[model samples]
Target: MYIAFALVLLFIGAEGLVRGSSSLALRAGLSRLMVGLTIVAFGTSSPELVVSVEAALSNQGDISVGNVVGSNIFNIAVILGITALVCPIPVHRQVIKVDAPVALGVALLLVLLLFNQTLSRFEGVLLFSGIVAYTWMSFILARREASPASADNEDILAVTQSRHWGMDIAFILAGLAVLVVGSRLLVEHAVALAGSFGISEAVIGLTIVAAGTSMPELATSLVAAFRKQPDIAIGNIVGSNIFNVLGILGVASVISPMEAPGISALDYGVMIMFSVLLIPLLYTGRRLHRVEGGVLLALYFGYLFLLWPE
Candidate 1:
């Protein structure tokens, strides 16, 4: 019953968030792509940040670390795969040139810092700083690309003018709140279910909690794709992955240093593999085709199959 309710909430939340965030972008003369990369991405990733921070504070270091790593993997492998299958998503040059590399870079950095299985407060600060820098750069880029064609701007303006800024803000906030609540309920129940089967905390965090917390991204991205806003769809996945590693883990570690002995080199390798794979997959035809989507889905399920507890 709770699972069904959470799914409903997640769908509603994703719709409101995508609508409000996209409309806000139109009103501000910014591209929906930029809005997706920043606001929508951060909103969807909030569950990961919250779950990780709480786990860190509770001294569940394995869960905290595993959640971030696993979510990053799921975001690319599953979220993007499903979005692409819904409709072939066009890859923006900015994402190829800037965002994708940044995603890969941060993933590498995280692995390097985690070689000793420890994340210190100082390293956390460094990672946290990356998000601030990335956000600032995005805004700067948004300003440069704010001037969409006059006809496109006019059409967007007509559609958005009826909606007030206050309503847009309300939609974004309410959507985020609902998403977080729904994600929490799902994750709690999922962990309990997994624990009933004797799954370790680290494995539970990596497989169940990670996917549960990422439900928002999956919902929002699929909605964006359905709405024919492919930029938002793609950006939400890439941006969320970046935030999952740099922002979520950074904050969690800063609050309390994390020692993740249960997160093995294989987990980190898989995360990095997904990160690296996105570059060519996106760059190949400048669009992610259904076949490529199938490949991603296969790889992700294969990984999960191998990871499944005996």
Candidate 2:
């Protein structure tokens, strides 16, 4: 019952966030892709940042690395896959050429850092610095590309302006409130339930807790797909994954360095594999088809099989 209620709040909160954030972007004459990458991505990623920080401060810090690695794997394989199945999400060429490659590079960098079994304070700063660079780069790129979008973008922008700025601000704040509260409720119960099953902290953080915190991203992307905003849909996943690795991991480490307690290389390899797979899979047709989505989802379950409680 609690799980169901929490999901309801997540869904509601995501709706408001997508609506308000997307409106804000359009009103600003910015591309939906930019809004999806920044606003929606940050909104959804808030849970990861909060949970990881609190856990680090409390000394249960091992979960930080596990949670981040697992969440990134899940985002592309599960969230993006499922959204693709909904409407066969279209991939932008820039994403294939620019965004996906950067995400992959970051993934490789993460693998090397994790090899040491410790994310040091200095490394945390480097990762956090990347966040600043990536955000500004995205803004510059988006503005340059905005003019090429067809008249449809103009129509959407006009519609968004019909909405009062005050209402949009209210929506953003209200959405954030419910999203945070709901994520907390869900994470607390989820960890307890996983513990009852004798699940390891690493596994719980990697699977259940990670998935719970990612509810907003899942909801936001699914909504974007249903609304026929393909750019927003895929952008949310790409953006969230980048945020998960760079922003969330960086801050968590700065607070308390991350180490994957008892986490195996095979597990880390699985995370890295999922990240690498995005490149070719997306490039095949510059689209993620329903069949491919199924393939990705199947791979996610396979990873879970490897982690299933002894």
Candidate 3:
């Protein structure tokens, strides 16, 4: 019952988070692409961020790593899968040329860091810095590309001033607070549920917990796809992947340096392979057609099959 309630809260909080953040971004004069890339991406990833922090503080480092890695896989395969099935996601050239490679690079870096059996404070700092730099660069590029014909910043400011920024901020804060508390409840119940079934925490995080947190991504991507805003949809996924790898893991490691568990290697391998497999679709004319979406979905199902207990 607690788990079910938490799931309900999670969905509600995610909806509020997305709408609130997107509205705030627009009110602040951000372009649609920038809103999609930064605000939307960060908002959708809040669940993963909260879960990873909680898992690290609780000393469940394996769950921390598993959550981020598994969420990324689900973000690409499942979220994008169902989104594409609804409406084909047209890949933007910038995503294919810039974002995809960066995501792949980050995945490889994660693998290399774990190869040494731990992600130290130094490595964490490096990863965190990379994330900051990437974000700064993305914002700069967005500003450069923004058209002069775009909506006036004064109009944006007027809209923001007309509304209660304080109220919106409060709503966002309250929603996030609820989400954090709810994530704890969900994770705790999930762990108990998994133990009763004699399932490993890693496996539970990989399947159930990962999928639960990824609901935001699934919802956002599907909505974006149906609206014919494929660039936003794809950008949201790519940005979330980067944040999951670098931001979530980096901060968690700094809080509690993760020692590579026995299961880490398999998880890392899957993450890298998944990122690699995306290269062709991302680069081929900068569009993920229905065929590419089908391939990605099939691969994800195959991965799930492999994860099942023998």
Candidate 4:
């Protein structure tokens, strides 16, 4: 019963975090794409980030690593897969030309760092720095692209005028508070529940914990897809993938060095392969039609088949 309640609360908290943060971003004059890419994406991934960091600090390094890697796999293979199945996500040229490459590059960097089976603090810093630099560059590009003829500028100004800046800040702080508290409770209960069932920590991390932390991403992506905002749909996944690799892992490692479990090599290999596989679909000039969406969904199901418990 406690576990069930924890799950409910986890989802509720994630929903609150996403709603508050996305609203705040909109209120702060951010463009829809920027809101989706930065606020929505980061907001959705916050639960995973918090959980991974806490796991690292508590010395449950396997949980930390597994949570990040599993969530990324789930984000692309599961979330995107389901979204595509619902509605074909159109591939924007900007994402194909710019974002997909960055995602691939980061995945490669993660593999290289983990080659020795451990993530050190220095590598963490480098990864985090890269995220910061990428964010700065994104903002600069957005500003440059906003023209006198573009409606985005009007949208930004309207958002800025309608809401009090203080209220926006307050909502952000409150949302974060809820997220941290909710994550702590969920992780504690999840670990305890797994122990009761005699489940390996790694397995718990890979499945239950991973799924729990990914609730926000799942919800946000589903909502975006339903709204027919393909840009947001694609951007959310792309940005979350980057954050999972760089921000979540980076922060966790900095909190404490993480040692990968025996199965991690297999997991990492799969993650890299999936990350790479996404490149072609995203890079193709054409949109992700139903057939392509079907293929991606099939690949995701195959991944799950391989990981399912005996």
Candidate 4 lDDT over 1-310, as tens digits, reads 6555655566666556666666676666677555655766777787788888888887787788778888877787778788877777777666787887898889889878888878899989998998898888777766766664235323322223225656556656766676677767767777897778776666677777887788777776677567665446677788888888888988888879887763456677778887888888766654665666777668767766666552
lDDT of 2 by residue, 1-310 (tens): 6756766676677667666776776788776656656766776777677667666655555566667777888899899889989988878787899888888888888878877788888888889998889999988887777665634433322234435888888887887788767756655666676678887777877887678678878876776677775656666677777888898888878878766655678777887788788889889888889999999999999888888854
The model with the greatest TM-score is: 3
Q: Name the 10 consecutive residues with the lowest summed lDDT in model 2.
A: 150-159
Which RMSD does model 1 reach against the true structure?
3.5
**How high is the lDDT of residue 101 in model 4?**
87
Best by lDDT: 1
lDDT per residue as tens, model 1, 1-310: 6755765666567657756776777688765545656866886777677678877876778888889999998999998999889989888778898899999999999999999999999999999999999999988876676565323323322234226888888887887787767756655665566678887778878887788678888877776677665656677788888888889998989999989988877789999999899999999989999899889999999888877753
Error of 1 at 232 (Å): 2.0
Question: Candidate 4's error at 298, in angstroms?
Answer: 3.1
Rank list by TM-score: 3, 4, 2, 1
Residue pairs in steric clash, candidate 3?
none
Query: How well does each candidate superpose onto the true structure, as a TM-score?
Result: 0.84, 0.85, 0.90, 0.87
The 0-to-1 C-alpha lDDT of every candidate, in the order given, reads 0.79, 0.75, 0.77, 0.73
Give residue 103's error in model 2 in angstroms. Answer: 0.8
Cα lDDT, model 3, residue 213 = 86
The clash numbers for all candidates, in the given order, read 0, 0, 0, 0
